[model samples]
Target: MEYRIEKDLLGEIKVPKEAYYGIHTVRACNNFPVSGLRTHPALIRAIARVKQAAALANMSAGLLDRRVGDAICRAAEEVAGGGLADQFIVDPFQGGAGTSTNMNVNEVIANRAIELLGGQKGDYRLVHPLEHVNLSQSTNDVYPTALRVAAIGMVLELSDCLAGLQAAFQEKEAEFAGILKVGRTEMQDAVPVTLGQEFSAFAEGIARDRWRLYKVEERLRQVNLGGTAVGTGLNADPKYIYAVIEELRAITGYGLARAENTVDLTQNADVFVEVSGLLKAAAVNLSKIAGDLRLLSSGPLGGLAELKLPQVQPGSSIMPGKVNPVIPEMVTQVAFQVMGNDQVIAMAAAAGQLELNAFMPLIAHNLLQSLELLINAVNIFSEKCVKGIKADEERCRRWLEESHSFITALTPHLGYDRAAELVKKAMAEKRLLREVIIESGLFTAGELELIFTPGELTRPGVAGAKLLEKKG
Candidate 1:
């Protein structure tokens, strides 16, 4: 069968019509049949760094033809400027250690360069994907380099989103400062705490996770791009490594350094695994926060009744006026998926055996997917949940005032035996602990009030309720 020819800007490159069935390539030919997702902004930036590194490496080694080097650099600029970025499409998921992805970029750049010179795709008889576009590079080196660049970009955005979430919780902290609620352990009321303190704990957890992610970002800055195929730099000049590292640093504004042990770099992808693990930890924390929100907002009149979440959507088709903590629920689901993806990454990293890690395609897919989901989840949680949360102040106050658990605070003053007896009587008779204490003649009304100031029980102070505060 004669293959139908599609002319690329380069000239006439013939892709087996059947081979273009991959998601990215097919989508590029279909939806963006006219244009694509505009060459992922992160990818465009990465390719620019790749070209810059390639040019610097070639120049330092006296192997660069000035004319071809100039053309490659120009093409890189055009791609970076969003020209032809739409032409490259290889599924973010693929095998071949991202060779398909690398080739997609190479083809687009080469084709665009050919157009600049009045040629066509596959007219690469002059400027070729392997010859000029990929000089001194292998998928082993280039693929990981691009992944690092893209991961760094994602980390930056994720960090910003996390900061926004932290700020949202912090604001809620101040807003709910005066509202007290029952604190629970093992799903049972254990003590008194202000709603503000609860939000602050959530914010602190996120802050710690954000710092961990930032630390992981540093690992991505040390790329193994100059390692070439087997990490021996077999076909590359010795000086190329240093030069490429310098150029990449310049292009990316990241503190990119060459791997000290390129051979180990080629053999182990534990770095990616570590990053995914950190992300999993963050996701777990997000899940915990979401779980708390769901539990606190479990029912408006039937459950804990301590806090209220913002209503983002209707909770039921059959039960009108029911609002669910859907935002947190979605965040919880994203967290679970991210956690599972991290396990997949760990297994893939462990599966790396001989000289080359062949599981990078899966690693990249998992990492990218985790980042996208986490970023979106953080945005939704902050916007729809944290920022919109309201304390059920009256309900919280009533729970605190009516709780028999508060009698525990009086133990230090009345002796444990007396306090226990009073608590038992209050629970048996279904009377308020305060009323039981006053009626039993354990304490006068003034002394009872002094011993049971809810604020002091919630947060310790030096005055009226010191013993109660200590017990709490």
Candidate 2:
């Protein structure tokens, strides 16, 4: 089948009807399968923004007729609503300077617009892809601009997830307020602390992640739209830049502004790297929390056994009463993937040599995949692991009471030499440190009781209250 050529301000380009089909067009079309990663939701959303901006620009410029503008706007609205996002299956890791992905979205929006106009597929004869749909944009500008908009959208979702997770930890903080366990340092018991303090620390880590995501979103809000074709604005009208940015901000509801230096915007992808790094930090925090949960829930028979994870599924094929903390395990795996994806993003960002970053497809794939995974992982961790977590209060108290390391807290009052002697004797005899302290003549039984009370040791104010109230 013969195909027609379409010319833009750049030059004439031939796209075959058989090979270059509409958005709904799919075949054995596997030639440009570079990254094999599909275009991200952020990229798709950005494409919608591009379409919206083009329509608005044309309407203002008196270039596009109202019928064409309205058709493009309506189609763009559908794309923005994510109706046509699934059709954008171009591999994110493709070559052709992201032209394939760009053209893929263009084709989809154009065909959808054509249908809206009561026209047939490949009916760019009425609403040309370059002339009407793409308008005064190039892949260089549009792809990156869409990327910025999409990143902002994703960051917003991540923000919500982080907030939810943070809140979940905060709730756990309240639930475990009085539960005391032996704190570990260098993997050895150190002192007594309320489990609430641990949960509060987890919440603080998530809050830091939330702050980093917000900062990354601020950088992503600066887009490269007006930097048409190598940041020169060669063929684009002077007013196209500001007008498109305004329209995109309205369309996306993000605080998007034009890049201060369009040349730098076109060439640099460091913002993506910064965002990816923040995601890595967030993933690390997640993995740390997961590690804590797994350790806390390690054994009902052998391990620490200080806390009980909510049992969601059976743990073993052979064991009858077995349960596992699968949610934290799954979150740990997600964190691992996020960390690896960050490496990919770092490499892609660094591979940008001179003019422009050619690895945008990879950058977009890794970054978006990280964001999506983290959001889902955070949701799962909050709902399955954190919200359902219950303090094993009796077990916690037993561990705290049994731990010889609580002697460290008494050392301040008993002197380090006496405390060390008591610990050595307790370890040798396998007796409770409280019992050893009382028997060793370092303190009387009543004095040992006063100093070794779990309530006073874990809750600072309790010790103060005992001293102030002259407890019997």
Candidate 3:
């Protein structure tokens, strides 16, 4: 391939003649090959947005020529619109507190802007990356600001995805409103509850998560965009500092505000930690519900057999006609990964020192990863799993009839001691509890029917008292 020589502090390096990225990006690509994963697409676009805003702010403050600023704006807009995705080749994992990423972005924009102004690529005389494109910014401010912007977009998308999951649960609740099932606690049968009530609980939990994500966006919106090197606005014009955030808000269309205490925002990575914790919370809820789905749909013949998940694929190679709850399993695994990502985010956030967090790259990488993971996971769970779940009415009824837990309902009618005795007799004889109660001559079959009807059993109040009193 044809190449151009570019000079930096480390002397000269060859750059691809046709490539939009320059020497800094080339160095970053060679220096860090840790994760095969590239900078997240959202983060790439966010960095472009930050560059565009900075150019505009500089032009407005009269520190930049309008002609240079316009060319930079056009090039940055192209990047923001995903024009040169191949140019951002640096891996997500790297040292230097994200300086590598920041410089990589600056060089790409500079070369692209040079090309736009009818100059050759790598011609810094036309558009210098550091001197023009990154005029009044530092990696300390630029990286974190872009991280917040990218995170906000993903958080909002994930929140909406959770709404889809919540709606799926609500649909199931309505579909199963009258289907009674035996609730379980600690792997033992508990009492009667409508399948709908159980789904309603799942919906409520997700609703809470959706709300939390929505509220957390506010915290992310507070950025340290104009803080320059150390959040003290060092070496940056006051007018440019004030105007940059406004430009950023306009460019990204997010309600972004410059942090009131930019120094505090710059040095601290706790907001990302808070966001990661919420993601973990959502993961916990999802893993729990997915586990429940797996349990409820455990077996067709040998297990609880209380639920029937949709069969999307073959379950086994040796076993005939075998089906599995694969979707819930997928969600559970994704949750586990997100849980791990949360821990990584926590450690990276806490590892930050004074005046700036040197671990922003780690925080940024894992934070965006968790958001993307959850968004896809939740959408899949809603569309592929929760929406397709089917309760086994026959199995539910059979389990309910056999469970000794229903004895609590009959206690008011039979007294506690008598109820315990009836359970023991039923268990010893290997007979149904209702049959043993009938054999005891405690009440007629008609009275037991009133006590055992699903509508009565799932609701509050003594099982047969109201109906029997009316009969008397």
Candidate 2 lDDT over residue span 1-472, tens digit each: 6665554555555555443234322321366555556778777767877888878976787777889889888888887887866677776667645677777777777778888889875767878777778788888888888877777878889988999999999998988887778889888888888899899999999999998897778888887787777887767776767788888888878888888888888888899899999999999999999999899878887887777888889989998899988999999999999999999988988888676888888888888889999989999889888998877788887887788756766665657897798888888999888888777775677765565555677765434345434643
lDDT of 1 by residue, 241-286 (tens): 7788887788778888888888888878888888888899999999
Candidate 3, residue 127: lDDT: 97
Q: Cα deviation in Å at residue 61, candidate 3?
A: 0.6
Candidate 3 CA-lDDT value: 0.90
Cα error, residue 251 of model 1, in Å, equals: 1.0
**lDDT for 238 (candidate 2):** 66
TM-score of candidate 2 to 2 decimals: 0.91
- Candidate 1: give the clashing pairs: 10-120, 10-121, 11-120, 11-121, 30-33, 32-35
lDDT of 3 by residue, 387-411 (tens): 8888889999899888886788888
Q: Which segments of candidate 3 are over 4 A away from where they belong?
A: none
Query: How many clashes in each structure?
Result: 6, 1, 0
CA lDDT of each candidate?
0.76, 0.80, 0.90
- Steric clash pairs (candidate 2): 35-93
Higher lDDT: candidate 1 or 2? 2
